[model samples]
Target chain A: MKFLTPAQVTALMQDAVDAQGVDLGQIRAQLVLSPSERVDWLIAAVENLRAFRQKL
Target chain B: MTFDPRVICRILAEEGTEFVVIGGFAAAVRGSTVLTFDIDVVPDRERSNLEKLARALRRLNAQLRTGSEVLPLSINADFLDQMQVSLTLTTDFGDLDLVFQPAGPKASYADWADGADHVDLGNRLIVAIAALDDIIASKRAANRVKDQAALPALEALSEQIKSQT
Candidate 1:
């Protein structure tokens, strides 16, 4: 599987805030995320990537 | 004493040490929010480069960190030249792992140099970091439970990155 470039990661982080109204940086900073909640975030991130990739 | 990694990077760069930051630090540099305790680096294996690294470590007051009897000894050029492939030391700045060969497609510092990412820290301080993809590959190869735990975040981050360019 191809890995993401630096620019792509930065763009995705920015897009998360702009398009999805989610700030992953803030989510990561939250200390109370349960194990399952973190898993959910990962799943959502993957789906986001899939959607973003299709747009390219 | 908690050591800021930016200081560690600057110290190495200022000393003209030939090395690349790898492992968790590299992942973090590329936007993986993985928390890492130590700064892992693959320093060039050449005698001269190792000499430079020894000097930098000395300046940091590096000492072997282990549960066994703590040795008050120090790492110097002559000692490093005769040492093994990897050494883990504790410094005033925290743990600094010197890896001679990282566990990945790129086995040595020279091998990864071309693919490494350069991070400019302003004021003419530049440091090399291993590529995120390679870090992922190495993590997968390591396959420890901790390493396994890091994959999802890194994978998802990779996807997000792939979407950008």
Candidate 2:
């Protein structure tokens, strides 16, 4: 597993919220999960979803 | 009155309480940590085991406080399979806190029972112990409250693992 420094985690959260099209509230909630859990959460929530549709 | 916390586990073992010594006490025995205190035992138990713990508390007049309710002689067993029982009861003399953990998550007594090493507690008795990695990982997993406690041990274990290479 990739270990994200505190700063990196913070940046990722900021970018997710700053995205003009998405809701900041939901992005922040995913970050509420512990730092260790966020990667898995994002992988399952975003990456996998993106992949699922790309494959189709 | 015994300085050794295992005294309580030994007593419980004799009393037919299905329990195992865990937490820092277990770590100390395994030489992972220098910490010592009253015994923390995870009992082989089911739901409502607190009633039995209450009876033991009555003997020591332990002070139990949860939310607004206060019951003397309290204990913490977060999990049935990995419960922690304090052989030391709360009283003026001093108190021993027994914390419990249920099965799974490497915090369970069942996990310890299966994977925990056996150490002699004298009198030809042996008790189950949690894995050093499991101990460090679980404590760290708790982050804030336990993360600090886990740091030194984790560092030590990391050194030991590296040295073994």
Candidate 3:
């Protein structure tokens, strides 16, 4: 119902990405992407994070 | 060559399909850190929207992912308007699960609409994604091993979001 602001959503996403072992360097590299492309990279990052966790 | 969930989301959004993105993909969008191969959505069961949903699925080349035989059933307006249960399909993009009943506190897309958040993925791809609380409730209600495992973190994330407000 209530929507989180874009800032809040970004902060939560960063926390989850860090907790799931996605590195800052990787995200930094993706920062250059357009907003749309950045969304794609983030989705891939989540998949990679899960794949990394599965190997452990 | 797996396609992102966004691919399907864009297709449905462009077709004006009335749906709320739910399940794991919703969790991921909300920053759950959970990975899901499929995109699950609860399409509005209204006769008009259901027809639109069928057309969108057809455009994606959806095939039955459930039964032993992978038939590409005609997801016509009749099927959508009449089907009582959820439908799961495999597509070029990936797995796409269309549910009328999502099995939690909010069992239907109609139940979830009030709480849904419209997400703009840039490039004119706008989707209505389920709220975090609803996703957590749905997962808890589903109670599968993976769903259970995801709870702790989702719960923590939910709390974190609450605290920020």
Candidate 4:
């Protein structure tokens, strides 16, 4: 197993954080959805993830 | 199993459990684009309400989730009264967290209820969602890496929601 150095780990963590940061465009798109729609969106996303995991 | 929060909310409502939806699901309901797989709620501490919640939990086949170990949970009003912190459980429908005292402004279930917005989830299932301000406050107080990451979008949504009102 290869172990990342401290600096390498920090850089990877920072990249993950950057990738997860907020996007105003996405927020606006989501705002167009009613509360019920939002719930459906979440459920769909979760189902997609579950399917993806089963393939692994 | 896939996460289905609507079914979870419906069960709670059907059992007449008094609870306010909180955490990431609440944020999503209020227009944040964050994707959360679990539903978090703050149930009323009143004995009768706790009994109702217990029935809902049983119907969900809920088990206490502690890291990798899933333990059987025997829930009742007394068990709920002794819980001073959050309880995370995995149900047949999805994950549910019962938060007794969230770390934010007016941190009680009653407080969240006082300012909650009634949202219709269709089919006559209306649930109370914690206000955007309260959700933001709780996330800020939690200060976890994921919570911190979600704050910006939630704050922007809050501003947008306020502007339209």
The candidate scoring highest on lDDT is 4
Poorest lDDT segment (10 consecutive residues) of candidate 4 chain B = B155-164
lDDT (Cα, 0-100) at B118 in candidate 2:
62
- In angstroms, the error of model 2 at B89 is 5.4
The Cα RMSD across the true interface for model 1 is 12.6
Off by over 4 Å in 2: A1-56, B47-94, B102-104, B161-165
True contacts kept of 2: 0.00
Q: What is the C-alpha lDDT profile of model 3 across B1-165, one tens digit per residue?
A: 365788898888778899998887776666555557788899988888977888899989998887565676877889777767688899878888888888787987788998998877676787888998999999998899988777766776676657657
Clashes of 3: 1
lDDT per residue (tens digit) for residues B5-93 in model 4:
98999999999999999989988888878889899999999999999999999999999999888999898778888999889999999
Quality class of the docking in candidate 1, CAPRI style: incorrect
Position B2, candidate 2: lDDT: 23
Compared with the true structure, what per-residue lDDT tens digits does model 1 show for residues B1-165? 554566777788878999988887667666665557678898888888888888898888888877674455567788887766678888886678888867767888888787897876445557787888888998898799888777767776676667657
Q: Ranking under TM-score, best-scoring first?
A: 4, 3, 1, 2
Scoring only the A-chain of each prediction against the true A-chain gives TM-scores of 0.46, 0.42, 0.44, 0.61
Q: Which is the better candidate, 2 or 3, if ranked by lDDT?
A: 3
lDDT of each: 0.72, 0.50, 0.77, 0.88
Task: State, as a TM-score between 0 and 1, how close model 4 is to the true structure.
Answer: 0.88
> Candidate 2 residues B19-104, lDDT tens each?
55555555555443333434456655555455454444444445643446545533444322243432334433223455565323
What CAPRI class is candidate 3? incorrect
Count of backbone clashes for each model?
2, 20, 1, 0
Off by over 4 Å in 1: A1-56, B67-70, B122-124
DockQ per candidate:
0.03, 0.01, 0.10, 0.48
For every candidate in turn, the CA RMSD to the true structure comes to 13.3, 17.9, 9.8, 5.6
